[model samples]
Structure formats: C-alpha cells, structure tokens
Target: MRGPVSEGDWRGVVRDVRVTGHRVTKRATHGRDKLLREVAWLKALPPKAVGYFPRVLEVRTGEGWAEYDMDFCPWPDMSRVLVDGTLTVDEAISGTRSLLGFAFDVLYADHHRPAPEDFFHVSYVDKFWRRASAGRGMSERFDRLCSAEQLDIHGRVYPSAASLMRELQRDTVLLARLRPPCLGRFHGDFKYDNVLFEPATGRFLLLDPRGSTVTGDSDSDYMEDLAKLRTCTRGLYDLVRAGAARVSEGEGRISWEWASWAGPALQRFSALDAWLVDELSVKARARRDADWRVRLDVLMPLLLLANAPFQLAPVNPRTEDIALVLHATGVRLLAEALELHGTRDLGVSP
Candidate 1:
C-alpha cells in the first residue's frame, strides 16, 4: 500500500506501520473522533509554538474511524525515560527540565486570560462518571474494589473507594468552586508518555492531546496538565503502567502489592513531588493566587480518578487487573488527599 505523498516529499506506506519512527498514523479506531480534535489542536497551536509539537502531514477519515499522519520523534518518551533503565538520574533531570520548558512554552502555554471555569466539574465529576455510565460497566470493577472497608496498597492505608466517591459526590460546593488561572490552549491529555524528546534538535515534542470533544466545551486549563504531570510524580502513572502494582483481596479488604521501583529514572522522578509543590507555590504566589496548594491537592486525585476508567479500557497493553488496581489506587489517593486537606477547600466540611 502507498501512503499519500505530499508535493516534493519522500514517503511510502508500509503495511501495519503502527510502530513510531519517521512518520506515524494515529487512528481513532473506537469512533471517538479523537483524531479530529487532535488535528484541530495541532492546527490551533500558535504559529510561534512550531517545534514543540510534531508536524501534521495528513488526515484521513471514514465511517467510525478517523486517522491522521504526523511526524514521529526519535527519542524515547518521558514515561520510558523514567523506567526503561537507560538514562541516568542526571540525564533524566536535565531532560525533564527541557521537557517542562517545551511544554510550558508551547503545549501548555497560557494564551488566554484567567476565567472562573468550574474546573472541578470538568476535571473530576465529568471525566469519571462519564465512563462509569458510558454504556458499558467499564468502571464497575473500580466500584467493586472500592466497596471494601479499607484499602491497603503497597503498605499504605486508604479509605474505601466507595466512601471516597460518595464524599466527593456529596461535596456540591467544591464542584463549582475551582477557578483556574487561565483557560486557553491546553494540551488536552498532557501526560508523560505523550511527550517525546528529539535528540538531534534538542526539542521536547508532544504527541497525543485530548480534543475539545473529549474534555469540556473548549481547549484550555493547564491545571489538568499539571495534574497529569503529578500523576507521574505522585500518582505513579508510569510505574503502574510498567506493571509495578498488583491487586488482591484478603480478609474482607482489597489490597495492592508493589514491586520496588528501582529503575534509574524513577529515583529522580520519585523525588519531584516536593519540587513540584515548591515550583507551583512560587508561581501561585507570584500570581497572587491563594490556596493554590489546596486547589492542586483537590485536583490531583480527581485527575487520578478521572483517569481510572480509561485504564479499565486501555488502548495500550497492560498487566491483567492493573485497571482495577489503578482505580483502587485512585480511590485510596483521593480518600487520603481529601482527608488530609478536609472539605474546607470545597467550601463545606464533612
């Protein structure tokens, strides 16, 4: 099969060219219209933010399937950088600094003024429940796991998943309380693996981005991006994806056992939570934003919970039952975060 050749461009279609190299085709096989939004966002990127993202070479669509072809970076993504056991700690830190620069300068650049967006509604309630009730009982496993009295995952105690969900659901004021600093030009799905490093060009490029159709009414909110980054640092998204977590039921409770994350890149990534808080604090103080930590704390677990359903129905390969473990972990984390911070941030205390 021959790929669509552009004027004066060298290209050929290799059958089943799913692996990334020079150019890659992203197909929304589930009729989700993800490619449409991705193409839209790629086009919407500021002209100045050129090198931060790949160039869109082609877009093709059909009934129940949409796809687009774009340049693929040669470097490993941040997720791989953290756990693939190749890059050293120093190398990971330096590369991560560059990744942040590229991401903030372009992919998550604040292009619009602040708006009182109901960030909670978008980040937590909408993303999570949308899947739980999205026709299939995709998230029911999470519900089952959470129904336990308590969760002990990797030696950490957490509230029951159902309990956390009920508390978060009951907090009506918090749902309408989140007002983000800016609401323009967000990457949609700004997670670790989606970011790539191009060595020869010293560029940190972004891959998958959530289309507007996938999220809220518009493409904005860097908080989601921050939450995703935190998902790696704190939520341990890459670690979980790497099959480091195990799930089990015992003595009337669900528990998780984890392998030690001794990879070279993880030592550095694991310590970044404090640094993230300090960095966000400095920025929030500069912005005169009060209770930024509270907001982030609230946002983090929501992002985790929102991400749970997708894990249950992952497109990439995953360890068997990792999705349930991920959901259980999110529930635990949410229970922990809300318990520590309390519901004052939500404008009501329980």
Candidate 2:
C-alpha cells in the first residue's frame, strides 16, 4: 500500500509492504544533506520512542537526491478525520488527553538534561515578523481587510487593522518577559497532520519531528507544540479546508470570511484549555509557583502569532489564504489572551 504525499512540497511518501511485512517511505529533495540531517535526527530518538515513528531501514544519497526507507504504521490521518467530522467529542478529548500524557512522559521526562547542540532554536516571533514585513505592513493590510469585513472584538469595533495589530503587538511585548514553567524535547511540529490515532491500541503516534530549524539547532520551546495544537483547535486548519479563507495571487493578500464559525471553534477548544490549566495548576502547586498559569496564558498568544507566518510560505497557490486565516486566528487568540491578563477564563467559554 502507498499513501499520498503528505501535504507539502518536498514531503516524503508512505508505503506499506505486505509481503515484506513492513512499511517503507522514500523522501527526495533538492538537498540531500538536509534530508540526511532529518533521517539522522529521527534515528537518534530513544528506542522506546522509535515505535511512535517510522523505523529507518535503509538510506541512499546522491547529488540533489536523498532517499531513505522506513517501516510504516497503518493509521488514518487525524486531519482527514477532522475534515470528515467523524471524530466524536469524546474521541477528541481522549486523543488529546492521551497525547498530553504521552508527550509529558516522553519529552518532559528529562527536562534537566542539557539540550543537544543540534536542537533547533525556535524564534517565537520570526514568522509574524517575516509575514508582517512582506507586501504592505501587516497593520495596513489588516486595516484594509477590516474595513471591508466586520470584526467584533469583544463588542468593540476597530476602524482599521492598524488598531488591532497595535493591540496584538502590545500584548506580545508584555509577554516577552515571561518564561515557561518547564522546557524540554518536544515534537517540534505537533499539528494534526503529523498525528495519528490507532483505534485498536488507543495510542497516538507522531510523525516528522523537525530535525533542525533554519538556525541549525532545535527549537526547545515546549510551549510551541502545545500552541500549535491550540491553533488547530482554533480552526485555522478547518477554515482552510472549508474554503472560508481566500488568497489573492501576486500580492500574497489573504482573507477569511468565516465569522460565524469563530465562536464554535473556540468552544471546541474549551475542554483542552481546561485540561491544560488543570495540568499546569498541578505543576504550579507542586513547585509553589502561582505564576505558572500566567506563563501559559501569555505564552499562547505569542505562539499563535508566531504560527501566522508559518502558513504564509510560498508552498502553494493558497499561500495567502493559509496566511490570512492563521494570522486572523492568531490575532483573535492574542486579543483574548490579552483581555484576560493571564486570568483563568482564557476566552474559552464555560
């Protein structure tokens, strides 16, 4: 069996070998060295964690072509499950709860260990800055869009995107001084696409751990993975899949018209938010640190903002749509985060 190429350019292929009784994948890219680096990183995971990832079997490389073979696991992609709406609320909570526990057991278990030199450095604001700098200023772009669209920010109306952008950045700067309660190895990319749930075993498996960042090190921010999960729950991916986000060519302009869906999306995240609060609260209690909740509260918006530009890269024609929805979602989340001022409500309704 062969699986379609996963959603991006330069992604590898997934294949199952029935006769050989194993699964395999072959990834090719313009740079063999880069592919090799990813393979090396995957191979370095602890033996127990290796079962969660595709097992490496063989490797071959040449100029401009790097290919590797790996044993595959047959599991339906969660993104497809989300798009199909086949997942029950119980299933969603179960998967997420299991993931949180598993991630804690795997990545957070050794928080004190010195980080590897090759660990990726995650620049929290780099994506927002990059997209914000491109085309027109981010504020100006959003201003024009807001003029055409009605955005109700907690019953207040913004005359332009400039105002909203100002608020978003203001909160971001204030959040910069905060530190995570804990940091350690994380599934650098912990979005739905990289996740799979096996109904039989009731286990969640992750794929494609980012081996390196542009700066040639690991992005050791554990909050990033959690933030990415929240972003998905906030409907960034759903909006893209539902055709609610549209992007214009050449200018890279993006817009999202799914106003009615925003509330429900946040509602869907309510359970997860509460779970996170509870989990963090337990940690804070153990350490006698009340600020743990605040750290998480402020960190959410910043991470969301960082994700805005992530989808804006020129990977497809819908680049603008991806950017627009992610940017708007991040901005909305940022506003909610700011309004609460690190309070427990967290803008996720009861």
lDDT of each: 0.61, 0.53
C-alpha lDDT of candidate 1 relative to the true structure: 0.61
Q: Which stretches of candidate 2 lie over 4 Å from their true place?
A: 1-34, 113-122, 134-177, 242-292, 309-319, 342-350
Candidate No. with top lDDT: 1
Per-candidate Cα RMSD to the true structure, in Å, reads 7.5, 7.8
Model 1 — which ten-residue stretch has the worst lDDT? 5-14
* lDDT digits (tens) for residues 1-350 of candidate 2: 11221222322222222324564656655445556766887888876677777777888776666777776667777665654556655676777777777776776564554434322212444334443444233343443443333344333432223343444344543444344444456676677777877655668778767665434444355655666665566535654645555444222233335445444544555554566557656644664544544545544555554554444333444654565555555556555555556322223222
Candidate 1: which pairs clash? Answer: none
Candidate 2 local lDDT, residue 196: 78
Q: Can you give the lDDT of residue 291 in candidate 2?
A: 52
Tens digits of per-residue lDDT, candidate 1, 1-350, equal 11221111001111122646677877665533445756877877778776677788888877766777877667888678667756555555566567655666655556465554555555456655654444134344555554556666555666655566667667665444456656666676667788776444456777776645233345455666776778777787887788876667654346666666545445667666666667767655765666566667766776666556555533333533566666665766676667665553422122
**Candidate that would win on TM-score:** 1
lDDT of 2 at 140: 38
What shift in Å separates residue 74 of candidate 1 from its native position after superposition?
1.1
